[model samples]
Target: MFNINYKSQHPIYEQIIDQTVLFLMEGVLQGGDKLPSVRELATSLGVNPNTVQKAYGELERRGYTENIVGKGTFISSSHQVEKDLAHQFKESLKEIFYEMSRVGFNSDYIQQIVISVLKEEEYVTDTKS
Candidate 1:
């Protein structure tokens, strides 16, 4: 469920963190879903177990996952987890918008693009429904 690009500029741990969060947000991973053990994930990804452990630690710190002494790690169901994820997404979007503005993108153009994308997604969802 996760892919690692050794040549990518992004660190392996960061990639793991991002993928886990994306999975959670997309509902591919729901609350109480067991995450792969560090050893299993490390072996599958061909990375050091330490890296996976670090990613899991970060997820736990961010309230995305919780560890049970004997049951392995599972996704958290706390409402705060969703709120935190939303806030993180908003901050990332803000950074992207600021970068675009720095490169001469105007607010009107940005709004139009965003609205267009949203409308297209809504259309797709409606058709699927």
Candidate 2:
């Protein structure tokens, strides 16, 4: 299932990619799961088929999905904690750190913030169980 927001600043294809990643991260989509065809998703989202194609292309490029010649696009079997994802995560963190530094947040303060968030996450996980 896909959720599209027409008013969002991000492009439709990017939103689709982000949501697909979220789905994979949340276990809503599993390894080897087949994705809807581009035309079907485009019809559901009321967007051009090319937009969904673009998103699927990016997903494959990012190692999230695999496209078979005649069958269909399927979720990557080794979806959990792949090298591509690890690199992407690091890049995202680097961007965040750079922006925080640009806004006058020192490295020590950033570390503290990250540690606090980690503690809070642990607390939440403990309570959930």
Per-candidate TM-score against the hidden true structure: 0.72, 0.66
Q: Please write out the lDDT profile of model 1 over residues 40-129, one tens digit for every residue.
A: 999999999999999999999989999998889999988877897789889999998999899999998888777777778885343211
The lDDT for every candidate, in the order shown, is 0.90, 0.86
| lDDT string, candidate 2, 1-129, tens digits | 888889999999999999988887688987899999888899999999999999999999877999998888999987343665677779999999999999999998998887778778885343211
Rate residue 70 of model 2 by lDDT. Answer: 83
After best superposition, candidate 2 residue 40: deviation in angstroms?
0.6
In model 1, how many backbone clashes occur?
Answer: 0
Supply candidate 2's per-residue lDDT for 40. Answer: 87
Where is the poorest 10-residue window by lDDT in model 2?
120-129
